[model samples]
Target chain A: MASTTLQGLPASPGIAVGRCWTVDRRRLRTPRRKVTEQEVETELDRLDVAIDLSVQQLDGVRAKFQASDGAEHLAIIDVHRAMLRDPSLVDEVRRLVRVERVNVEWAVKRAVRKIKGAFDADDEFFRERRSDVDYVGERIVKNLMGQGSDAAEMPPPGSIVVARDLSPADTALFFHDRRVAALVTDAGGVTSHTAIVARALEIPAVVGTGKASTSAERGDWLVVDGSHGLVVLNPSAAERAEYEAARVRQMEREAELTRLKDLPAETVDGVRLRMVGNIEFGEEVPGLLSHGGEGVGLYRTEFLFMGRSELPTEEDHYRDYRALLDAMGGRPVTVRTFDLGGDKLPSGQKDHSENPALGLRAVRYCLRHPDLFYAQLRAAVRAAAHGNLRIMFPMVSGVAEVRAAKWALAEAFEQVVAQGLPARMPPVGVMVELPSAAVVADRIAREVDFLSIGTNDLIQYAIGVDRQNMDVAYLYRPLHLAVLRMLKSVAEAARAAGISVSMCGEMAGEPLYTLVLLGLGLDELSMNGPSIPEVKRVIRGASAREGRELLDRILDLNTADDIEREVRAEMARRFPGLLEGGARVGPVSG
Target chain B: MGRLERSFVIVNSLGLHARPAAMVVQASNRFRCEIQFEKDGLQINAKSIMGVLTLAAARGASVLVICEGDDAEQAMAAIGKVFESGFGER
Candidate 1:
C-alpha cells in the first residue's frame, strides 16, 4: 500500500508508531415499526427495562472509574446517568410508544431527536449537550434491541486506536488503562470530550482526521505524530525510522522538562526570578504545581463573568477566589478583577463602541459600575484571609485609575470589617497593559504594591496592530524596539518606586525571549505551566550580565526584524539547539 | 397541601446548563410535588431535565419555580438550596 499522510488537529502532544486498532463503532440502527394495540403495553415495559439497564451500565462505568487517578472525565458519566433517568427523555419515549404505537427502539430514537431539537442551537456548549443526548438515546435503543452495552473492546497494548467517532464512554473505556499508545479519530474537535480525555491521560492523539478510521485497517502500521497532527499510514522503513527517532527525542525533551521542575528560575549570575503560572480556575492548580509553579501571577477573573447573562454575585467571587487561594497553599495568587466591556462582556451586554479596545474597559468599566466592582472587591478582600491573595486591576491607563481602584478596595475592606467577616487588605497592583500606563509606569508604580506588564495588550496598543488581523499579524513582534523600550522603562520605574515587577505575558513564557526578560530586571515571570520548565532552564544557564548586554545591543537596533534576528542569533549562540525547534510554547495572546 | 412559588436568578456562570439542569431535575424528583419552571413565559416541568434545559435561562435570567403538592414546601426548600449553591459551580 502507498504511504498516506493525513493532516488533522493536534489534540495531544506526543508521537506513537504502532499497528492500528480499528474500532468499528457502527451507528446502532433503530428498528422502526408500528406495534399492534396488544403489543403497546409490552413495548412500554421494554422501554422501562431498557432505561433501567442503561442507567445500571452507566453506574458500573462510573464506579469503575471513580477510583482511578485523573477522574475528571468521570463527571461526564454522572451527567449521562442523570440524563438516562431524565423524565423529559423517558417520558417522551413512553408517550411516543403509547401515542405513536411504535416499537420501543423506534420510540426512543424519535424521543432523542425531539430532545436534541432543544439543543440544536449553534453554540459549542449546546452542541456538546446534543451529543450527550444522542449517546443516551443510542444506549436505550441498543438496549431495547437486545444489544449489549457499547463497551469498547480492549486493544493490545501499544496499538494506535482509530475510530470514526467514539462516544465519551467509549473513549473513557479505551484510554482508561493507558495501554493505547495513541488515538486517531475521523471526527472530534480539540474541545470534544474524546480530545479532552485523551489530553488528560497524556496519550498521543490526532483528532478530526476526516478519514483516518476508514483509511487505516486493523493491524496496519501507522505513525501518529500527535504533536503536529499528522498521521502516516503504511510508512516506508525510512519514514518509520525517522518518526521513531523523533518520538525518542520528544520523550527525552519531556524527561528533561520534568527534571527541571524543582529548580528555581535563577540566572547563573545569582539574580533570582519567581516562576509562576497564569491560570483561570482551581482545576489547573495541580498541573501548575506539577510544572513547579511557585504561584499564580495572573488568575484571570473574567471567565466568571463570561457565558452567563448575570454578573457573578459577591458570593460567587468569594468562593472562586477562596478556592484558588487555598489551591496555591499560601503561595501568592494574583487575581485580576473583571476586565470586561472590551471584547468580553457579560451576556446581554453588547459593545457598541467602534473601537472597544480603547473604549470603556477594565478600570473604566469597574469605576462606572461600582455595584459590580464592589461585589468583586468585597470578595477579594474576604478571600485574602484564606491565603496569599494579590488583587491587580487590569488595563490601568494612568495613576488616577490605580488610585480610584485602590479606594474601591479600601471601601470593600472597610465594609467587610464592619460586617465582622474575615477579611484582609490584599496587596494591590496595576496591570501596565495600555501604552498610557506603560508611559507613566513610574507614577502608577508609586500607587500600587507591584506592577505586572501585560505585554500582549501593550504590544498591540504600542505597535497599533490588531494581531488578529491576518494582514497585520506579522507586525505583532514581541521583540519590537518600541515594546522593549516600554518594558525597560517599566522595569526601571518599578525599581525607582522600590516595588517588585513581574511580567505575565506571552513574552515571559517564550524561551526565545527568556534572556531578554531577564535582562529587563523582572522579579517574576508567569506563563502557562508547560512553558515554566523550559524558560527556567534558559534562565538557569544564562548570566544577568550577558542578558543586560544583549538588551543593550537590541535597544540600539533600528527595527523589529533587526532586534529579532539579533536575539535569535544570540540565543542560538548562547544555548545551542534551542531555536531549532519551531514549537510555540504557550498562548500568543490572552 | 402546600403551594409555593419563588423567583430565582440563575447566578452560576454557565447558566442552566446540563449539570445544573440535572440538579434541578434531581431535586424536583426527590419529593411528591409537581414542580414547574417558567422563564420568559415558557413553562416547563422542573422534573424534566430536557424541559429545564430548553429554558436556557442564562445567568441573570429570572426563573419562577412553582411547586404544588403535599410535599411542596419541602421540595421548594430543597430546590432553593440547589439554586443558592449555584449547583456547586461558579
Candidate 2:
C-alpha cells in the first residue's frame, strides 16, 4: 500500500518505528430500562456495589503503579480514587436510581452527563476534567454491567499506540506497563496532562492528530516521528529505509552522548563548565547523575509543599532535603524556596487577580507568611548538615526582599540552634527572575552568594509577553536583544560581585542556546536531567572564546528573527545533527 | 448541636475540582451532620462529589458550607480545615 503521512503536534521528540496498536475506547452501551418500584432497592444495591468495586479497582491500580511511576502518576490515580468516592457522584447515582427508577448503568451514565454538563465548555481545564469524570463513570458502568474492568488491555510491547484520547490513568498504566513505544492521540495538546506525563515518561508522542486512530489499522507498520509530529502508515520501501537510517544515527548519537556522562563538562578550550540538573523530586537524582549532572542547580521545593493538606513542617522539609542531598553525594543542591502562586497556588488559595502571573506570588507570598517561610528555611538549615545545600529565594525584586527573607532564615537558624539541632547555614541566593531583579542585579548580587537567572520568567517579564498565551508567544523571544542584554547584565553583575551566576531555565538545556549561554559567561547550566548529555556534547565541542564571539555578533542583531537565523546557521555548521527538525532549534520557540 | 456555617474561598489551583471535591466529601463523612456546600447560587451536599463538581467553583470562588447534626461544629471545623489547607494541594 502507498504511504500516508499525518501531521499533528509534536508533544514529545523521538522516532518510533513500530506496528500500530489502536485502542478503541467506545463507550459501553447501557441498558436504559426503567425499574419497577420493588426493583429500586436491588438497583440501588447494585449501584453501591459498582461504585465500591470501581474504587477497589482504582486502589489496586494505584498500588501497582505507585512504586514505578512516582507522585505525578500516583496523583492521577488519587484523582480517580477521589472521583470514585465522591459523595456527590455517589449520592447522585443513588438518587437517580431511586428517583428515576433506572438501572444502575443508566443512572451512572445520566449522572455523569449531568455533572459534566455543568462545566463551562469554554474553559480548557474544566473541559479536560469532563473527560476525567466520564472515565470514572465508564469504570463504574463497566462494573455495573459485570464487564471486566481490565478490558482496556495493554498493547503489545513496543507497539505505537493510537487512541482517540488517553486519560491520565490510562497514560500511567501504559507508562508503567512499558509496552507502548509511542503515543498518537486524536485529542489533547502539549499542555494536556497526558502529554505532560508522556514527556515525563520519555515516551515519543504526537497528540491532537484528529485522525490517527481511524487512519491506522492494527499491525500496520507505523513510524511515529514525534519531533516533526508526523505519523506515517504503511511506509514505502524507500521511506522505511530512510527512517531506518535516521533511527540508527539517532541511536548512535544518544550512545555517544551517554558515554560523556563520566567526563567533565569542559569546553574544547579547556574552560571548565558546571552542568547541573534542575529537579522537582528526589527520585530524579539517579537520572540526573546518569546524565553527567555535577550537582542540582535548581531543586524546586514547591513540590513538597504542594498537593498536601498541611504545610511542610521543618521535619518534612528536612527529611526531603536530606534524602535529596544524600542522593546527590555531596554535590551542591540549590533549593529554591516555594515559588508558589500563579498556577502553583495550593488548593483553597484563591487568586482573584486579573493577571496572576504578575500578582503576589513566590517571595512575595513567603514574605507575607513569615511563619510558613521560616519552616522551610529551618528545614533547609537542618538538612545542610547532610550535604552541600544552598537556599535561594525566587522573585526577589530588590535587596530589601532578600534581607527580609534572610532575616526569616536567620530566625529559623536561631530556633534550630536553640533546639540544639544539627544545623548548618548554606549560602543563600536570590533568583533574578523579574525585570526589576535583573536591572538591579548589581545590588542583589552583592547581597547574595550566587545569582541564578530564571530566563523563563525573566524573558516574559522583560518582554511584557505572557509566554503561556499563544497570541503573544511570538513576542516571548529568548534571543531578543532586550533578553540578551538582561542576561548579560545579570552575569556581569554577578561577576563584578565575585558571585557565581548560573542559568536554570529552558534556555540552558537547548543545544541551540548552550553556546550563547556559555558565551555570555554563565558559570553553570542547569536543565532537565535528560537533556544534559546532548547539551554537554555541545559544550565539549566549542571554546568559550568562540561562544563569546558568537554572542557578540548575535547581540548586535536588531530582531529576534535575525538572531535566530544567525544562531541556527552557526549551530548547524558547528554541530550538524544537534539542531534536528531542520531550522527549528529548540523544542519550543521561547 | 445546631446548624453551623462557614464560608471559604476555594484556593486550590483546580478549585472545587474532583480531588478537592472528594477531599471535602471525605472530611464531611467524618461527621453525622447533613452537610451542604453552597457556591455560585447553587448548593450541593458537601459529602457528594457530583454535588460539589456541579457547583463548578473555580479558583478564587467562595463556597459557603453548612452542617446540621450532633457534630455540626466539629464537622464545620474539619471541612473548614480542608478548604483552609487547599485540600493539601497548596
Candidate 3:
C-alpha cells in the first residue's frame, strides 16, 4: 500500500478502519405527479401524510435525545416542523404536480429550494448546519408528493462512516457502538455536529476528503490518522510500521492524559492554578468536567448561530445557558459573547470582507442586533444566579465597547429584575484578542473586573501571521517576545486596575508558555478542557515566584525567533511534544 | 392481501429522531397500508406518536403493534418498530 493525506475540518468522536459508507444527500428524489383529478386529491392527501411522516420522523429523533438533552436537538427538528407546517409547501407541491406535472422528486426539489432560499438568507450560524435540515425537508416534500422513501444502507459499524456530510441523526447510531471510527466526509465546517462529535469521540476523522474513496479499493489497506487530520492510503511497509508506532504513541499519550482526569492541579511548589475549560455546548459539559476542568472558562455563544433555519430567540438563549450553568454546579462559567467574524460568521452577513478577523464581530454584532444582544445579556444575567457565571465580550479593542456592553448588561439586569426572574451580576470581562485591546489593556482593565489575554488572536494580530494559511501557518509561533510583551502589558494593566486577568487560548495550554504567562503575573489560565490537568500540574511544579522569574527572562527577548528557541530548549528539558501542535499560539488574528 | 400482524421494536436508544421517524413514516406510506405502534397496552397509530409520546415511552420498556392494509404484511416485516420496543437494547 502507498501513503497519502486528506485534510478537512475535524468533527465527532471515535476511530474506525472500515469500508466507506457514503450517503449521497444531494441525490435526493422528489415526489411523483398525479394522472387524474381523482388522483390529485389522493396524491395531495398522500403527500400530506408523507410530509407528516417526515416531520414526525424528525420529532422522533428529537425525542430520543430529549431524555439526556432536553429540547437541545429540537433546534433543527423544530425547523423541519416548520417546513412540514408551511402552507406554501402544499401550494408548491400542487403547482409542481398539478400544474408543471413534474415528478414528485422534481416538485419537491423546487419547493425545497424555494424554502431553503429563505433559510439561506437567514443568518451565519444557521447557514452552517442547514444542510441537515434541508435533507430532512427534502425527504418530507418528496414523500408527501408520493416519492418513495430514500434509504441509504448504513455500512456496518466497523465500516468507516463516509458521507458528503452527516447530520446528528446519522451520528446518534454510534451512541455505544464504537467501531465506526475515522469519519471521512466530502463536506462540513469544524463546528459541524458531525465534526464536533468526531473530535469528541477521539476518532481519526478526515473530512472534506473529496472523493477520497476514488484513490483506493474497499479492501486495500489505508491509514486514517484523524489527529493530524491525515489519511494515508497504500503505505509502504516502513510507513505502515512508522504510523503504527506513531498511533501507539498517540494512544499512550491519550491514556496518560486520561489518568489525570480526577487529579487536582497542585504544583510541587504548592501553587494551585485555576484550570478551567472552554464549553461550546452542553454536551461538552460532561467531557469538560470529566477532564478535571474547574469550570467553563470560555463558552462561545456564537454556537447558537449553528444549526437550523433561524436565529435563536431570547428564550432559546436563556434555556440553553441556564441548562449549562445548572450542569456546572458552582463552577465558574465564562460566557464569551459571540466572537464570530472572518470565516465563522453566518454566511448571511452582508459584504463580509476577506479580512473578517479584523472586521466586525462579537460586541459589534451584538451592538448591531441590539434586541438579540440584550436578550442574551438577560439570559446570562439570569443564569449567573444559578452558578459562578461571568459575562465576557469578545473582540473588544476600545474603551467604548466595554462601556457600551456594560451599559447594555446593566439594562438587561434591570429588565430581568423587573420581570421578577432570579438574577445575579455576572462578573464582566473582555477578551484581549486585538492588539489595540492588549496595548491599552490597562485602561480597559480598569473598566472591567477581569481581562483574558486571548494570545491566539493577540499573537496573530501582533505578528500579522495568518495562523490558518498553511504557507504561513508555520510562522505562527507562541513564544514570540512581542506577544509576551503584550501579555505583560495586559497583565500589568489588570494589576494596576485591581482586576484579575486570565488567558483562555491555545498558548495558555502549552506548558512552556505557562510559566511565561504566569511570570507575567496573570491570575487565571483556561485552556482546552483536556489540557487543564497537566497544565495545572506544571503550574504546581513552579511557584508564582519561579513563573515570575521565567516571565522576566522571556520578556527581555526581542525577536519571535529567540522566544521560540528558548521555549523549545526549556520545554525539551522538561516535556516533549507539549508545544508541538498547538500553533505555538492560537487562532491567527488580524 | 390480508392484513398481517407483526411487531418491531425501536432499537435506537432514541426511538425516532426526525430522519428516522420520517424514514419509518415514509416506509409505512409506501405500502397501501395502515401502521400503528402499541406500547403499554395503549395503541398508537404508528402514524402519530406526537400522542403516544404524550404517553411517554421510557428508554427500557415493552412496545407492541403491527401494520394493517393492502401491503400491511410486507411493511410489518422490514419496519423496525419492534426494535423500538427496546428488545435487548442496552
Candidate 4:
C-alpha cells in the first residue's frame, strides 16, 4: 500500500506502530432549540440534572484513579467536579433560560463561551486554561444530551488513538487502560494537559495536527514517529521495514541509557561533570533520583507563592526547602528566590507594562518587595541546616542587585539566628540570564559564590524574540554567534573569579548542545530529570578535547544553520544513531 | 436591609479560576444575602461561576465582595475567609 504521512507538533517523544483507533467525539454535540416562558422551570431542571450527571461521572472517574495514587490526575478531576457544581454557571444558564427563553443546551453553551471569551487574553497560561472550561462544557453538554462518557468505547489494546482533542479526563481514562500505544490529536500544543499526561504515562503522542482524525481511517496500520511529529498511514513494505529498524535502534538506545544510569557522568578524557536537575515541584524528586541527577541545580521557589492567595511565610518556605534538601541526601541544592512577574505573575498583580519581558520582574520584583525576599532568605538560611542548601537570585543585571540581595540575605540570616533557629549562611549565586549580566559577568562573578547561566531567557532576550510566539519563534537561535560569545564570556568570567559555573536551561537538556556546553567550559549542566541519561551518554562518549575542537570550528561559523549543521554532523559521526531522528536541533524556541 | 463589603486580592497564581470560583460561590450560597463580586468595574453574582470567571481576575487583581441582606455581614465574612485562605491553595 502507498504510504501517506501527516505532520504535527511533537508533544511526546517515542515511536509506536499499531492500528489506528479514532475516538468519535461527535456524540458530544448538543442540538439547539427555543423554549417558551412556561418551559423555563423545566429547562432549569434539565440544566441541574445534566450538571449532576456530569459531576457523578467525574466522581466515578476520580474514584478509578484514586487507587493509582496519581495526585495530579485526581486534582484535575476535582477541578472538573468544582466546575460542574459552580453556582455562577448554573445561575447564568437558568437566567438565560428565563430571559432569553433559550433551551438548556444553548444557555449552557452561551455561558461557557462567555467564560472562554474572557480567558482569551495574550497570556499563554490563561489561554491554556480555556481548554479546561471547554472540556467541562463538553462534559455537561454530553450529559444533557443523555450520552455517557466516551470512555465506554475502549480502543483495542496497542492501538494508536486519534481524536480532535483529548481532555485531561479523557487522557486519564486512556492512562488507566494502559493499552493505548500512542495518541494523535488534531488540537493541542506541547504544553496542553493531554500532552503533559501523555508524557507522564510515557505514551508516544503527536498533537496539534489539525486534520489527523479526518485524514486517517480507523483500523489503518499506522506508524507514529512522535519525536518527529510524523504519522505514516498504511505504510508500504519498505516504509515498515525502515520504521521497524528505527524502532529497534530506539529501544537499544534506551536500554544503553538505562545501563549508563549508575555510571558517573564523565568525559572519555576523565573530566568529571556534575549533572543536576531543575525542579519546580517536590514530587519530581524521585524521578530526578531515578535519572541519576547529582543534585538540584535550579529549584524554582516561585511555585510556593504560586496557586496561593498570600505570600508564603518564612516557615512555609523553610518547610518546603528543608523537605527538598533532605530528599537530595546531602547533595547540594541551589534554590532560586521567587522569580515572579512577567509570565509567572501571581494573580492580582497589576500588569502595567506594554512589554512584560523587559519590565520589572525577577530580581527587580524581589528588590521592590524586600520583606517578601527576606522571608524566603530566612527560610533558606534555616533550611541550610538540613543539608547543603544554596540560595540563588534570578535575572540579576549587575553587581548592585547581587550586593543588595546579599545585604537582604545577611539580614535574614541575622533574624533567623536571633530566633535561635538552626541557621547557617549558604553560598549565594546569581543567574546570568540577561545580556547585561553576561557582559558585566566579571564584576558580578566577584560578588557571588557561583554563576548559573539561564540560556532559555538569555537566548530570547538577546535575540529579541518571544520563544512562545510561533511567528517569530524561529528567530530564537541558541547557536547565534552572539549567544555563544555571551556564554563563553560568562564562563570565562566565572573561571577568572574562581567561582563555579553551571547552565540550567532547555539547551543543556538537548544532546545536540551537550558537547558544545562542556567545551565552552561550563562546570555543570542541569536539565529536566528525563534528559539526564541521554545527555550523560553523550558526555561519556566524547572527550573534552574533541568537544573543544568542535566548538572552535563551529565558533567561526556565521549562521545558526551552519552552526547547527556542523554540530549535528560531528555528533552523528562520533556517536552513530545518537542523533538519528532523536534530538530536535533547530527552531526550538520554547 | 444592611449591606457589607470587603476587598481581596487573588493570591493564587491562577486567580479566581474554576476551583476558587466554586469556593466563592459555595461560600456565598451559605447566607440569605445577595452577594456580588466586582472587579475592574465589572460586577458579577458571587454565587455564579460563569459570572465570576467572566471577571477574569488574575493573581494580584483586586476584587470587591458585596452582600446585601439580613445576613450580609456573615456572608461578607465567609467570602472574605475564602479569599484569605486562598481557597486552601496556599
Candidate 5:
C-alpha cells in the first residue's frame, strides 16, 4: 500500500475507501507564440458567444435559488458582466489574436494569462476582483466552444476528487457533478469557500492536505476520515472494510443525533445551558435557529467588510443586522465590532504589518477608526431594541483597549438616543483571546458583563503558534493544561464577578471538550450551525455535575497528554464504547 | 534615472495568498520598472505575484531578477540582494 502524509481541508467526517486516478496539469495547453486573420475573427466570435451563454447561465442560477441554499451566488453575474465589457481584456486578446493569428482557445488563454499577471499587482479588493476576471476568461473560452468552468473533472459514480488546490469555481463544479463523494485539496483551511460548500453539501471533505496530490489521488484506493482530519491513502482491503464499518457506525450515530435535534440541550440533572451559534453571515441565522440555538454567541461582523469597496453603509449594516434579529425571533444576537487587524483587514484600509495576527485588529481597529466603528455600533444598538443585544469586543490585548471600545459603544448609543430613538443599549463584553485578559480576567470580567472565550484565537496566541502554520499546527491544543487552566481561571473570575462565561470557537463546539467546558463553569457553548443539535444531544444525556468532576480532574493535569487520555477514558466509561477514536465524547449515543 | 531592483520570495508562508501578494505588488507600484523574474523556463513580470507563483518557485530556489524601473539599477540591486538571501530567509 502506498502511504503518505498530506495536509488538507477536512470538511466532513468518516473514512472512504477509494482508488487513485491521477490527473496532472499536463492536459493544459501551453502557450504557443507562433496563427491567421481567420483565426482571430473566429476567436472573437467565440468570445461573443461565450458572453451570451454566460449571461444565460447566470440568469438560470439566479432563477434556481430555491434549488440551492440561497445565498445570492448570482452576484458573480455582475462581476462577469463588468469583465465582458472590459476594454483592456478585449483589446489585449485582439492584439494577441492579431499578432499570433492563434485559434480562439489560444487567444482567450493568452489574454487571461496576461491579465492574471497585471491583476496580481493590485490590492486585496482588486485581488478579489481578479476572480471576476477569471470568469470573464472562462466565459470567453466556453463561448469559443467548451464545457463549463471545471477543467476536466468528471468523476465516475461514487468517486472522490483530490487536487493540489480548489478554486471557488472548482467547488461550483462539485455541485454540478453529482457523483463526487468528497474532495480533498492540498491547500486552504476552515475559512475557504470550498469548506463552506462541503459543509453545506453534507459530504465528506478533507482540505489543506499539504501536497494532497502526492498522497491522495482522484482514483487512489483510500479511506478518508474528514472529522478528525485523517486520510489513509490507498488502504489495504482489510483497512477498507474496517473504515466502511466505521463509516456505518458513524452514520448510525449521526442519525441518532438528528433525532435529538427536536430535544432541548438540557441535562438529565436538570441544568439548562443556552446553546448559541457563532455565525459569520446573516444567512446562517435561519439554520442556527432551526438547529435549536437560543442565541448567537459570536456574530462575527468582519464578513460584512469582506467583499466591499469601503465601509458598508449604516443602512446596509442595519438591514442585515435587523434581519438577523428577526431570523432568530428576538433571540440574543451578539454583534462584535469590526475586527480589522493586520490579517483581517478590509481591502481599503490595508493595515499591512510584520506580524498581523498579533497586530491592530478587533478592538484596536475600532479605536483607530472610531467613526466607522460608531456607525456599526449605532446600527447594532438599533438592532438591539429588536432582540437580545450583546456587543463583543475581539482581540483585546489589555483593559485600556476594552475601555476605549466601550467608550465608542456608549458614544454610538448616545447618538441613537439623540435621534429620538428609545435607548436600548446592549451589554458589552470582551473576547478573552489574549493571555493578558486571562491573567487579569478578574478585572476585565468585572468591567464587562460577560466573557466569551474565543478559544481558537486564544490557543493561537497563548501557545504562540499560528494555527495556520502546519509545522507548529500540532501544538494548537485547546485541551493543553495551560489553555484549560486559563479557561478555568477566567470562568471562575467571570462567575465571581457575576458575569456569564462562555466559549464560541472551534474548541467549544468539539465534543471532546464539551463536558470539560461545562464543568469549567461555562454558561454557554456557541458553535457552527450544524453542530448545534449533536452538542445539545450530548448535554441532554449526560450529568453536568459528573461532567464537572471530569473537568476538575482534567483541569489540574500538568500535561495535555495526561488530560486527554483521562477525559477520553471518562467519556468511554460513560458512553460504554459508543465513543470511538475520539468521535467527540459527549453523549456518544446521540 | 536609476532604477531599484530586488527579488523577494512570497512570505507569510502562504504561497502568494491575497495579502502577501498584494504587499509585493504594492511594493513594486512605487518603482517605475519593467521588473522581470526568471526561474526554470518561466520568465514573467516580477511586479506580478500571479506570474511569480504560477512559475511555482518554491522556497529556497534562486530566481534571477532584472528590472528597468526609475531606480532600475537600485531596484535590481535591492531585489537581487533579497533573492540571494531568499528575502531575509523568506
Candidate 6:
C-alpha cells in the first residue's frame, strides 16, 4: 500500500507510532415487528433489563476512573447513568413499547429520535447532549438485541485506536487501563468528550480526521503526530524512522524534565528566579508542586464564581483559599479577586457595553460591586493567617485604581477584625496589564508591595489586535518591539520602587523567551506546571549577563519578526534542538 | 394540601446543562409530589431529566416551578435549594 498522510485537529499534544486498532461502531439495525397486546409486557421487561445493564456498565466505567485524576470526565458517565434511568426517556420508550406494540429496539429508536427533537437547537452544548442521548439509546438498544456482552477484544498495549467517533462510554471503557497508546477519530472537535478525556489522560490523539477510520485497517502500521495533527498510514521506511526518532526524543525530553523536578531555576551566575504555577483549582496543586513550582503566583479566583447560579459567599471564598494555602504548605499563593465582566461575567449579569474588553472589567467591575469584592477581600485577609497568601488586583489602569482596591481591602480587613474574625493583611500587588498601567508602573508600584505583568492582555491591547481573529493574529507577537519595551519599562519601574516583579502570562512559559525575560530582571516566572522544567532548564544554562546582552541586542531590532528571529537563532545556538518538537514549530524563516 | 409555586432565575452559566439537569431531576424525585418546570409557556416534569433538559434554560432565564401533591411543600423546598445553589457548580 502507498503511504498516505491525513491532516486533523490536534486534540492532544504528543506523538505515537503503533499498529492501528479500528473500533467498529456500525449502526445497529432495529427490528420493527408489530407485537400483540400480550407480548407488550415481555417487551417492557426486555427494556428494563437493557436499562439495568447500561447503568451497570456506566457504573463500571465510573468505578474504574474514580481513583484517577479524570474526575471531571467521570461526571459525564454519571450523567449518562442518570439518563439511563431518566423518567422522561424511560417512560417514552415504555409508552412506545406498550401502545405502539413495537419491538423494544424499534421503540428505543423512536424514543431516542423524539428526545433528540427536543434538543435540536443550533447551540454547541445542545449538540453535545444530543449525541449523549444517541449514545445512551444505542446502549440500551444494543443490549435488547442480545449484543450487550463484552464483544471486542482489547487492543494490545501501544496500539492506536481508530474510530469514526467514540461515545463517552466507549472512550471510558477502552482508555481506562491506559493500554492504548494513541487515538484517532474521523469526527469531533477539540471540545468533544473524546477530546477532553484524551487530554486529561495525556493520550496522544488526533480528531476530526475525515475518513481515517475508513482508510486505516486493523493491524496497519500508523504514526500519529498529535502535536501537529498529522497521521501517516502505511508510512514509508524513512517516514516511520523519522516519527519513531521524534517519539523517542520526546520521551527522553520528558524524562529529563522530570529529573529537573528538584533543581532550582538559577542561571550559571548567582542570580535566581522563582518558578511558580498559575492555577485555577486546588486539585492541580500536587501536579504543580511535582514539577518544581515554588508557589502559586496567580490563583484565579474568578473560576469559583463561574458555572453557578449564585455568587460565592464569603465563607465559600474563605474555605477555598484556606484549602489552597494549606495545600501549598506555606508557599506563597497570590489570589486575584474576581476579574469579572467582558467575556467572564457571572450568571445573571450581562455585559451590554459596545466594547467589552475596554469596558468595566477586572478591578473596575469589582469596585462597582463592592459587596462581591469585599467578600473576596475578606476571604483573602482571613486566609492569610493560615498560610503564605498574597492578594493581587487585575487590570489596574494606574495608581487611582490601585488606591481604590487597597482601600476596599482595608475596609474588608477592618470589618473582619470588628467581627472578631481571624484576619491578616496579605501582601498586595496589582496586575500591570493595561497600557495605561504599564505607562504609570512606577506610581502603581509605589502603591503595591509587588507588581506582576500580565503580558497576554498587555500585548493584545498594546498591539491592538485580537489574537483570535486570524487576520490580526499574526501581529500578536510576544517579541514585538513595542511589547518588549513595555516589559523593560515595567521591570525597571518595579526595580526603582524596590519591589519584586513577576510575569504570569503565556510568554512566561515559552522556552524561547526565557533569556529575554531573565535579562529584563523579572524576579519570578509563573506558568503552567509542565512548562516549568523546560523554562527552568533554559534559565539554568544561561547567565544573566548573557541574557542582558541578548535583551539589548533584541531591543535594537526594528521589527517583531527580526526580534523573534534573533531570539530563535540565539536559543538554537545555546540550547541545541530545544525548539524542534512539541509546541515549537520548525526553524526560523528569513 | 395544595400546590406550591415559585419563580427562579437560572443563575448558572451554561444554564441547566446535563449535570445540573440531572441534579434537578434527582432532587425532584425525592418527594411524593408532582413537580413541573414551566419556561416560555413550555412545562416539563421536574422529575424527568429529559423533560427538565427540554426546558433548555439559559442563564438569567426565568422559570416557574410548580409542585403539587400531599408532599408538595417538602418537594418545593428540596428542589428550591437545588435551584438556589445553581446545582453547586461554578
> What are the per-residue Cα lDDT tens digits for candidate 6 across A1-590?
77888999999878888999999998888888999999989889888899998899887777767456465577788678888988778888889878888888998899889988888658677788888888899899889888876556899999999999998878877888899999999987877788889988999899999999999999999989888788889987777888788788778877878888888899999789999999998768988998999999999987778766678778778878887888898899999888879866987678888899998899999999988899899989999978899999999998888999999999999999999988899999999899999999988888899999999999999999999999989999989899999999999999999999999999999998999998999999999998899899999999999999999999998999889999999999999877876434321111
Arranged by TM-score, best first: 1, 6, 4, 2, 5, 3
Which candidate has the highest TM-score of all? 1
Among these predictions, the greatest DockQ belongs to 1
- Candidate with the greatest lDDT versus the true structure: 6
- Candidate 2, DockQ to 2 decimals? 0.26
Cα-based TM-score, every candidate: 0.89, 0.68, 0.57, 0.69, 0.57, 0.83
- Please tell me how candidate 2 rates in CAPRI terms: acceptable
Off by over 4 Å in 3: A1-248, A306-311, A340-347, A351-361, A398-400, A460-478, A496-498, A530-537, A540-544, A577-590, B1-90
All models: lDDT? 0.86, 0.83, 0.66, 0.83, 0.68, 0.87
Candidate 1 per-residue C-alpha lDDT over B3-86 given as tens digits, one digit per residue, 9 for 90 to 100: 899998877666787768777888888898899999999999987777887898887688999999999999999999999887
lDDT of 3: 0.66
DockQ of each: 0.53, 0.26, 0.02, 0.33, 0.02, 0.39
lDDT of 6 at A367: 95
lDDT per residue, candidate 5, A1-590, as tens digits? 64544445567655555665444422344345445665567666766677677667655544543346434233334335445545456666777777767665677677776777665443444454455466567656655556644346466766777766554455565555455776776655664555656666666778777766775545567666677666677666666787777777777867776677667778888877888999887657767876777889988777766644456667556766777777778778888878777866775566667877777777777788776788798898887877778889888877887888888888888999899985578989999989999889998976889998889888888899987788989888888988988988998999899999888889878776667776886888999877887677677778789888888787668887888899878767766543554444221111
Across A194-270, the per-residue lDDT of candidate 3 in tens digits comes to 66556555566776667665665554555666644555666566665665666555566567567776666655656
Q: Give the TM-score of candidate 4.
A: 0.69
Residue A528 lDDT in candidate 5: 88
- lDDT for each residue of candidate 6 in B1-90, tens digit (9 for 90 to 100): 789999987755567878888788878878888998999999988887778877888765779999999999988888888887767643
The per-residue C-alpha lDDT of model 2 at residue A17 equals 81
lDDT of 2 by residue, A60-98 (tens): 767666454545556666667777777657778889888
The TM-score of predicted model 3 comes to 0.57
